[model samples]
Target: MKLAFPALSVALAALAGAHALRIESSEVAPPADIRGEHQELERVWSVFSAEPLEKLHLAVPGPVFVRYDSSLRPVVTPEAAPTRGSAAGSQDDDESVEVSAGSAAGAVKEAGSLGSEVKEAGSLGSDAKEAGSLDEAAQEAGSFEAGSFESDLLANVTSHSRRLRAHKKTQDDDKEDDESDAPEVLVARVVVTGNSSELLNMLELLALKKSSNNGLRFHLQNADATAEGFLLTQVQLAEQHVLRHLTTSLSSVVDVAPRVLVTNSSETKVKLAVQGASGLLVNEPEAITLRDLDVEISGSGFVQLNVSSVQLDGKLNVNLAGSGAIALHTPSINASEIKSSISGAGALVVEAENLTATEIVTAVYGVGVGSLRATTRGAAHKQKITIAGAGNVYAGSVVANRTKVEIWGSGEAYVQVKEKLDVSTAFSGNVFYVGDAPEDVRTSGYFFWRTPVQPAAEDKYETHAAIASPAVYPEHVSVQTKQARHSVDPIVKKISVGAQSVVLSSHLAAVAHGPNALLVFGCVAFGLVAVGMFAQSFQQRRARRHYRPLV
Candidate 1:
């Protein structure tokens, strides 16, 4: 909704109190104009200032989204006070912005120009010459008819006149005007209105400028203030679904934790990134690539990253709860690391070429919650995915050369590998191998299963096992199953077979040299029989010599 500056009653007391509102080197411009500059200023602003208005506030009870806009920033103004509206004009060179208030408004402090006060003080100091005449009158009267006591009084009067004259010179030495010390302050208000749902989302965009009312005013200060420094001081949210998309790039130093925030991204152009929890959603034609963003998304708001190009770099943290999910749809992802904590029943899914992380470390503690991806490019050097609780990971056609897949708790994990896959599962979850299964070497609770197409190998090796609790013993339960690839074509036919033996003729000739081997075996057999008879005779003699009876 288009909003206008409303008729707001400024607390005249605040502006005029002991600490008068003071603003220096800044002007109050139309706030609608500020929104247009947010996208244009991707670099540091040499000047800093603020714009304020009591415009319409959007109160949304749903979710809020922030995204970048390539379109021209619209220049709009809010409705002013009903009586006279607002008077907006600029100085002769258009370097100055001026706003005039109508009814129910307090006064605006203008730049100071001392007029009568300095002249009045100067006139008082000039009166010292008139006081000198009193000293002459006193001397004349005392000399003519006064007694000895009157002469002493005339001397005291002359001394008092000289001292009063010195006061004027002292005042002139320190003649700086007092009015120049205080800076001029611009007083204005920001008004927000909408349903609580809309306002919740809109509140994330609000920014305010705070200063001491008595501080000296600054002049020609750059008015490039950003909304990044906005503090989320007060937020009252109801149970409502609010969704919004906003993109902002600003340089603001945060003094307090903002109710909503996007932090400083120095020097590099942020291609596009979704560094939050819940979910990320974007479906632009020239999709924004995510890079160098750290966002933690909570609540039930889901974000989708459906951009044309996106990168996840730096340290990214994702937290999801309830029923919302964080989804990625076909985006180039290059991340240093992605750390996630999942609770409740939220799911994380990356479809097709939708997921890529150099190092992914995730923990899932909720029921049926997990991180699953169907396919990913093998651009990363190494990829690691770890799931805990009742969660698991599935890699349908991922092509990462160096990857590690791990699972914990009562959930199962099945992953397809192109190069190498090291898996470790604990508790009741079954570990299924997709392409190259592990060698049959038993450590503890893990068993290997071969694909159904390789049935002979599955039978040759132990395909399954009954987990044993040696403590409880002889009662055994059988466990074994054959896994088949999903939706595979059943038709197959042999193409060709070679009739020629592939072995080298030289190796066969080496065996031909052993023709005398049978003759050697016959001689060896005859020699063994003679040796056996001699041993038997010696054994009979030794038995007779050492014979004894048990009785």
Candidate 2:
């Protein structure tokens, strides 16, 4: 029984060795490839974390093997199988065969033992399969979760959002800067290309909104006296698209009303009307009207119609009509011709070098025409009328009736009278007898003649009065006469004579010579009588006069 026990022990030992070898060859060798595949799968999972699975598909060889290292368990290596021996002796051999059979049975039993291990390994494999299925499910779920997480992270990490936020901040800063940099609305400049009605309407609107103390004000360009304080109606303001402003250029045109209306503060509103080939109209308040009011007319072939007030710092060729007074201050009126009746309470001063008035009737304290003329009728009913021209006539009349006329010239003044006309001069003139006048009447400077007959011969001439120097004529003289129910008075005095001679005589008296000769003869006779009496008295008085009263 002791010997049998030893043999069974040896047999059991041999069976254990063979089982280990089988396990080592079958299970342990496969696990090496499995572990390596697991590492590769782990690397793939990391790659999927960054890039999409589809993108990694092209880089990887095949479907990646993923193995879960649950609990990080270590793999076991199976032991090698034991070797068999050859024996001799028939009986011994038979016994050895029995022993071997017993050993085989033992081996079978050992192999049976391996069945449990195999079953355990199969169970482990099943577990590994289940774990792999679970891992796949988790991986699938992780795909969605990772994708969602990546989307969320990307949304937050994107540069677009940051850039948008920065842009919004920049816009806010720009808005603040604009608000801070904006200037105050103290003055408003409006430019109008057309009429003044729109400007007037705008003014009315402004007036309605403005404070009573802060009234609207404006300045009219080249406004006449009659155009001051002109009133404008709403209708007029609407039809004209005139611009209104605080201040405007003077080169532009302004159409103002005949009267100017203002608020209680008496803030004058000025309107400007440009009347030229190319013109503009502007109406502005006086407060801000001091800026550049230069209105420039541009473009060729432009026509500007009737304008109320035009301040011309530029060229102008258009008609102007103002119901009010027109003030021309350094204004240039250039046109084919200018014809307008100017009437103003204020004086009219024309400082223009060239002015031609067809009919000028000025009623002012003073009127100055500098190289100007009234080609037609010019009446100056002012207190003083001064004509500085070399040829100027105060009156013109053609009739036998007597009329008072005053003419002044540095040259000669010719006066022709058809009827009995008396003329006096502080000068001298040549005399020629056309009618029946005696030689004495023709040769005298101061003489009285009535139907005097001219002598047939030139030698029968007589002298009335002669100057001592002859070269210098009297400076002060007068001529007056009353004949046939007529009285005449001279108007002009201190007449000057040049190299030309002048004649003076009444037409009726110049026809006869008896009256003039008789006056001269009577003066001579009286002179002789007085001289004889004076001589006789001197002689008698020397002989001692007696009682002359008794004789």
Candidate 3:
């Protein structure tokens, strides 16, 4: 029985050893769902597995779930357990249970309990599947995470705050740049409309950089102002603070029809130079210095200057009823001229070098140091003309009228009278004075002398009437003796007693005489002789009678 027992025990031991628990062709069936949620398991396997899980695709399927220990380690199953009452139990039962317990404890140390491992493996597999699905969806949607998972989540709140800070920083940079690049405009045009006062105020604002009050200052850098197409009723400028550096240039034509006053109080003085087509209607005084000023005035007004002077390098056309004067140092009417054709009571004084006039009427009066020439074509009945100068006087003709014509000069004066000349002057030259005196016309002077020219008898009444009038003689007259002289010709009948004696040569004759004594003496002598003859005849008769008979 011992021999039999030993052999049988050996056989039983061999059988039990051969049937020990072991994994036989372990195969992991894949779970039905595999996605990003299962990626943790994959990562765990990557950590635990010696080789890539993909290489073990044939082995690991579903979720790598299989009969496992607490550590999720693959559990090897025994081929067969010892029968309950078999001789192997009594021989190896304790060893087999002890081995199993050791294996269980090792698995617990590595992976935890079996239930917990199963749960974790399943969750990891699910998470991996979800991650895969999300990746696929992101690819399909054409989107990407800006950062990694943790980074993407944190960027939401933090990125907005970062962006806001960056935006503020950019704004600060822009402001810094703006401080260096401020914009500015060089020149601009402006139009102003209002009354004269308003217009003047605007001009003062632009030119002087202030309003009516000179105390205020403007912020503008350069003050240059101009005006056009403005109608002013009455405008005046402040006399104190007119800007001297202001410049105005016309872009178009302008017309100003009001009283304009321009004054200056600055030490440098203000100047206004105008060009283009412009007209001014000045009812008051306008003081300015003109360089190339072309001004036209159509109203009856005057332009008075209170400053140094006014110069015209251009033309001025004025039609005025009042008088206007120009104050100049060396006043000259240069090549640039002025035309003043005013008819109604007006006077123009040009204190210049020279003045020229075409025609002047009777109501016009002018005074100048230059030359004055006048021509008269119409008849004047009783005209009193006076011309006093060191210059010469020239006239065309003088008719027979009660006209007083006086020409006085320290120089030589040549006078030609076509009609009767009644002279009263101290003339120096041997005047070739020729003219017929009518019966009522006479010539008288201080030294009265005339060439002995025979009087024409055909005008006897005119000659006699002229001689009979004592008031019609020239005062200072000295006649030349070489010429033919005649006195009391047959054509001259009557003679006056107190008439001035006139010497007549043989070429000249006197036919009339006053009463003399020679003729009276001859008449008395003849009468006395006739009376003596009568007495002698009477005495002879008496003697004869006495001798014969007493008679």
Candidate 4:
């Protein structure tokens, strides 16, 4: 009975060892299809393979939500490699390339007959298909009404593009149809029971993989938190579709940011949280509606994010906190508005042609710089800019229909406003106004003419400042007390002797096994200040013009 139990236990353990976490595919509607209008990522996998990953690159051709979670392992079974004898083509077998997962080319081979299959992709049938597709596109290009020429032309162009893509896919398949076929990779989503699962040795094999229909997606769980993040290459999407809910959070310990290229998507909104030192670059978007983008970094994590919008149906709200920089190129259109806030020492730069916001509120808690460059002739609505911060805000060319600027704090709001202006400054903050100032600019304790009065067109100071002549500092230094009339040598020697003695005593204490002797530092500092005053006095005495008294 004992022997039987041990045998049974061994068998069960073997069975458990054979199965681990299973990979599955959910019912995700992929982005625009090849024949449809979307391309999306709809699957995840922990494949089987014993190779190491050199690089990890996933390119999803649509808006993809990436996260890490447990449970729901989709079961999959890998297929055996197909033999060379399985080739059904009549062509010389020497030309057959064994296409495999490692190869960049692959296609599903369809059998034409039971005894023999059509595998000669370079044969006359493929040529006929290509010729037929071209003929159809050409026919589509011509069959259109005279009045609907532009619409028909667009349709024909899209048709031709699809055909060309299909043809290219065919050609790519032919290039690797005969390569030494590696092991066949096959996996289907299946229901599994129990919590235990096994992972395949597909580390390097899965790296830089291009997932079809699902585009390309990879998730990192708690088990993979220590592992390095991945990069995404080309994932192209069509118009009317936008890359949505794309959130990337980088570790503060990581030195490199994930490189992503998103362009021409109708409404692309990206939120990137860089915890450490990393940089991200977002080139252009057709119409971006960024909402509550919070980039909070603790360490010296520098993030460079550039977003451009041509149209907007939503507001742009960005909240930044950390030690880095974030800049934006807002839309030139007047319908959009932006709301931004900054904390911790992070720099923000905005370049826009028309910044006609309904209620623009910008605040900086820490010592960061917020700058805005606006260049527009006119705006329809009354633009209101409310700025409050302890940091500097340099807003250039606040030219609009009716501008209202309100500011407070120790920060400076350098602005140039046009039309009717309603200005308010408080808490000793400066409102350096250019162009014509409104009559009702309420001020308290804050300085309006804090800067020089000379103003230029468009509220910019264009002229260069002239250098001041010498002999400008004699009033303070020339007025010496009668007690000091004895000589400059005694006081100079006293200050130098005190400074040297303190420094020597501090060094001796440090040598005598003291823990950071900072006692003598104050004396040295005072002596240095006195020496600086004496030096300045000497320079002023030399620089002062000697006026001969009329005898």
RMSD of each: 29.8, 55.3, 61.0, 26.9
- Any runs in candidate 4 off by more than 4 Å, and if so which? 1-242, 251-273, 285-308, 330-335, 353-358, 375-389, 401-408, 444-551
Q: For residue 404, give model 2's deviation from the true position in Å.
A: 8.8
15 Cα displacement, candidate 2 (Å): 99
Q: Rank the candidates by TM-score, best first.
A: 4, 1, 3, 2
Q: Which runs of model 2 end up more than 4 angstroms from their true locations?
A: 1-249, 252-384, 389-551
For candidate 4, give the lDDT: 0.38
Worst 10 residues of 3 by lDDT: 54-63
Point to the candidate with the largest lDDT: 4
Q: What value does the lDDT take at residue 184 in candidate 3?
A: 18
> Per-residue lDDT for 1-551 in model 2, tens only?
01234444554465433212110001111122333211211110011011111100000001111111222222324342211222212323544343344433445443443324445455434554666643344456664354466545654554465567568867964553343233221111111111222221212112212322122222221111111111211111111222222121111122333212111121222223222111222222222211112221111111111222223222222112211122232212222222222111111222232322222221111111111122232222111112211222111111112211211111111212233333221112112222243212222121223222222232111111211111111111111212222312111111112222223343321212213322332344345445545655666687566545655
Q: Write the per-residue lDDT of candidate 3 for residues 101-129, one digit (tens) a residue.
A: 33322333233433244344454335545
Which is better, 1 or 3, measured by TM-score? 1
